[model samples]
Target: MNLIKKSAIALCALAMVFTACSDDDNDDKNTLGDKEGILLVTFGSSFPDPQETFKNIDNAAKKRFAGETIKWGYTSDIIINKLRQGNGEGSLKGQIIDNDTPQEALEIMVKDGFSKFEVQSLHVIPGEEFDELKEAIHAFKEKYEGVSVKIGRPLLDSDADIKAVADILAVKFSEELKDGPVLLMGHGTPHAADAQYLKLQSELQKLNPNFFVGTVEGIGFDAGTTSIGGILAELDKLSPKATKVTITPLMSIAGDHANNDMNGNTGESELSEQSWKERLEGKGYTVNTVMKGLGDYNEINKIWMDHLEDAE
Candidate 1:
């Protein structure tokens, strides 16, 4: 072959090799690595005290899955916006809190070399928030090919879960049960999963007649079975007539719903929108409030951890 022709062929072959190498490099950049990460997604609370509940869950997850990358995601845009705007009430007031949404958190993990993720939902029920988290994860997976993600179910995903939570509550509120009825106020949803509240109530009643469950939104399979009015009716039916009641939140964190809707005081006027405390007081019964979340309880947190383990 002529020297000029051979030289030209050699140069072309070398250029093809370089092109292949560049393509390989680009592929490597898009592909995820072998590292695993845990993303705990919650509806999120703007209240400062509830932030501790998230911290507790994060710490527990880190302890359980030591050396694994762990991060948090807030599913609620309203809470995220409030925190970012420094409009968060109480301790969060005037302090801008930078928290990531589920999508952003997952992207951060991917950038940090996490390829496998166990996305756990810290929601009380598999309701709207939980559904949105799932959708976000789905979109994330579509955006990032070759990444593996498994989602942990919410706190109450099945009848077994309801029963398990009921058992925990029975022990958690044993002392309150002795005094009189213990009312648990959950953040109810328009979603069908709201019926889980009724199932939980039934389970708790089986454990102790003094146990009752209600919702702030007054939604469920039967609103009458999961609302404050329903609780009042049941309270009246309590044999021997209960003279006192203890109210507590069934949510992961005792934030706005627990503080305002369940236990808020709206002055002495009988006409104002009544909180659970005021309603119970108006019923002529001694009422007490417990401002704590389910996450505050180790056993309840363990249940969530178990769900994560199952997902893994």
Candidate 2:
């Protein structure tokens, strides 16, 4: 009876040891920190060239953070819906992913078992979209107890960043400056963050007298210095000898606003009534519009990478 009891105890102990080993193996297989990735969130564009512009930014990020998997998200529901519905413009219909918001991208990463990752904004300013992105991250952080996440800043986060952007723009439009005034159009917001556009204008003006910035939203903080009207008035006061004005987007992608608001036609019968290009031409200044987003510049895109590297 004693031998039988000992034999039974030995078998039980062996079974317990095997079960512990199996559990350890399972834990190793399901380790929480085993994978990580990056998600680049932006306002999104359906325009063909700007779609490539986004790809360029993504490529730069992949090169900068070589090993990590990189993903993308668009903050605009209208754009995403258009892309998913196969109605996006040109060849870009196939390029844009279908996620409507950064939260969806985060949910996807979580679903894919990414235990850690970073969310980087491609926004030019820390305005409404960036604020919404932060809220999404906060919610995810609460829900995903074991997942680690970090966020990167927008392009114009600090005075130093703004100056850097100005320096790059100075280099980019060096030749154009000689011909005429270079006006950059930023998408303005009612949020106090619109101050960034004014600061950017100041920085660019400090770099070169001919450089200016204006907004489409007419929320320019200064008493009379942000709309196309305000900029034109200021130009009239300066009486620049240059006979031409070069216009370009200060936003990440030169999509709807850059195409229609800044360079579209101006007529009672036209769809766009008062474009910057038409308004400047009407003022007797020859207009030159550069329909390229800031992200199209490698130097400008590098600023985003620097921001990503700064994230902890």
- Cα deviation in Å at residue 42, candidate 2? 0.4
| Collision count for each candidate, in order | 0, 0
Model 2: what TM-score?
0.86
- Write the residue-wise lDDT of candidate 2 on 184-295 in tens digits: 9998887768788888888988989899899888733365338888888778877645688899999998898898889887575655468888888888999888888988
TM-scores of all candidate predictions against the true structure:
0.87, 0.86
Give the CA lDDT, 0 to 100, for residue 103 in model 2.
78
Highest TM-score against the true fold, candidate: 1
lDDT of 1: 0.85
Which consecutive 10 residues in model 1 have the weakest lDDT in total?
A: 90-99
Tens digit of per-residue lDDT, candidate 1, span 1-312: 599999999999999999999987665456677788888888888888887877777778878888877788888889888877867777764322247898988888887788899999999899888888888888888887889999999999999999999999999889888899999999888898888888898999999988888899884335533778878887888789999899999999999888888999877675766899988999999998889899998888888988999983
RMSD of each: 5.0, 6.5
**Residue runs of model 1 more than 4 Å from their true location after superposition:** 1-29, 93-98, 219-221, 268-272
What value does the lDDT take at residue 274 in candidate 1?
84
Q: Give the RMSD in angstroms, all C-alphas superposed, for model 2.
A: 6.5
lDDT of 2: 0.84
